[model samples]
Target: MVEPRPDQKKGLKERCPELLEIARLVSWCMNRDYLIRSCLDHINRRLGMRARCVLKEKEQLKLHCWLGEYECRMEQMPICKESIVWKVVEEGIPVNLTETHQCEGYSHTLGEKVKIKAIVPLWYADQVTQEEKRVGALIVDSGKMGMPVSDEDFEYLKVVGELIGAAIGKAELTEQFIDSYKRKEIMVRETAHAFRNRIAAIGGFSRRIAELARDKDLANEAKMIYHEVQLLESHLEQFEKYL
Candidate 1:
């Protein structure tokens, strides 16, 4: 392994706080998009390089999030023959470079220089399957001078990217569970309501029977039904308070 320059080592040291905060975000932040955006902003601001990530959705690679003036010009990156994003995600390796050059997806013009930087693969730690899944690519934007982002920064980005991907996947799963639970809860409540309505009908009919019936046996049965229904309704009302 090549030794990082003193400046590079210092850069990594300074990024410790950012890394910790990113980890916190991953664990606790409910808003997945905000977490991703915050992480990218931290990378760009601390490292002086722009960053974005694109994950594969079906057959197409779509931009997930980006932070750079150049990125604003394009809605999404092209995944054609020249796309560097496609290669890195497919191969699972960083296009280690000492100098920046124009490449697809990561390409952008600044003054007269075309700056396209290296990309590192992002992996998500699947909670359900307990597997590390290669999910996306971290795209870097070379600075105005067209200098390549250091390998150390690439490593840092990969670490944070992994967290981001996992958090996003987890958030999606949580949302799905919430929606499913809500649907089931509604069904149960509706069923309870219908059951209560039927009980109320029985109570009403029993009360009328008790009032009108002359036969002692029938009147007694009607009164018992009405009293039992009232007791059942009291229990149901208590349960419904929780709902």
Candidate 2:
């Protein structure tokens, strides 16, 4: 792992409190949006810079959450193929760049003068494929000219990216589980309803046949059919209730 710069290491003692808070916040957050928002808020508060979390949505890099003074026109917009964010996503590595103009797409959208300190890619394993994927990037900018990004800040952002990735992966799995459960529930409900309707129809017809039967044997058989239908109806009711 890359180590923090010597000057950044000197201030690590003073950053412990914020680090602890971030740890607590990340651990407690299960929702993707909440986790990203809280993480960005914490980083912005501690660093006094604009922080944004952008997630990949289909082909676009949509802004998931953000904090501070930077205007995010790229929110919900497609990430340009030539942009730095795209580069980080493609490389699956953290990048520190002082000049925004070097990234053509980023400069075109946000402007050439926009000051960006670093962009860190957030990665998570796909639930279905189990393959590692770059889900998004955390972009941090000082919003001022020539502010060098510190190694400690980069290290902290990397940790935040990992936490966000884990949270997003867990949340996606949870959603899939919930959706599967709902589908099963709907199937059960529909099956139960259809079974109940069929049983009710059989019971009704048998009861009517029993009433109209002239022969005692025929009446008794019809009554027995109704009784069996009633039992099946009771079982279906129980099954529906269990579901």
Candidate 3:
């Protein structure tokens, strides 16, 4: 890789520290244990405004992570799922707002505090099957402690939101994997004694049958079963790696 000139490096750090910080934070999200609140704090500091993460909890939007001046008392907001910002999340797109009047589903009271903004949905694939799924949305509101949000803030928020979404997806995957492992641990412990012996015996014979079975279909079925077990083992290895 070519090294940047001293002048170029200094210029980048001075003029684009916010973008650099965003990149660093996203890289941190590769490890699922990274807290969403901490991330919001980082973004808030970068943008010099409030940032929050709203998750699609059942039929309502719930504030999962938040940072900044105003107290977001509406923890469980019952806005329509199809509302402007929520629709962007549900559709896995970014919603940029240049003015408060253009917002949908937000309480009128919040209009004074919220300014130009961008809401980006963090979409991810099901870790096991890689199915498209919408997990959460990141909310970035512009303006200083007192100033109203502006178009420039909206543009910055929109760009930042896109990069942040990728990190959110990675974090969500880690979270889901951790949850799955915990659940699997409980189930495995409950039945380990009973299943271990049976699996060992079957595995031994299945290996032999897999090599000698005359029926191609039966051999393939045995192979598939072994592959499933291998997948489980791989997950266990990942749990250990993380632990």
lDDT (CA) for every model shown?
0.72, 0.75, 0.62
Write candidate 2's Cα lDDT for 180-220 as tens digits.
99999999898888888888999999999999999999999
lDDT of 3 at 216: 100
Candidate 1 per-residue lDDT over residues 98-202, each given as its tens digit: 554335245322232344476778766667788766677777755455666676776776777677777778777799899999998899899889999999999
Better of 1 and 2 by TM-score: 2
If both were scored by lDDT, which would come out higher, candidate 2 or candidate 3? Answer: 2
TM-score leaderboard ranking:
2, 1, 3
Give the best candidate by lDDT: 2
Minimum summed lDDT over a 10-residue window in model 1 is located at: 104-113
In order of appearance, the predictions have TM-scores of: 0.77, 0.81, 0.54
Q: How many backbone clashes does candidate 3 have?
A: 0
Model 2: lDDT to the true structure: 0.75
Q: How accurate is candidate 1 locally (lDDT)?
A: 0.72
How accurate locally is residue 228 in candidate 2, as Cα lDDT from 0 to 100? 96
**Model 2 worst lDDT window (10 residues):** 1-10
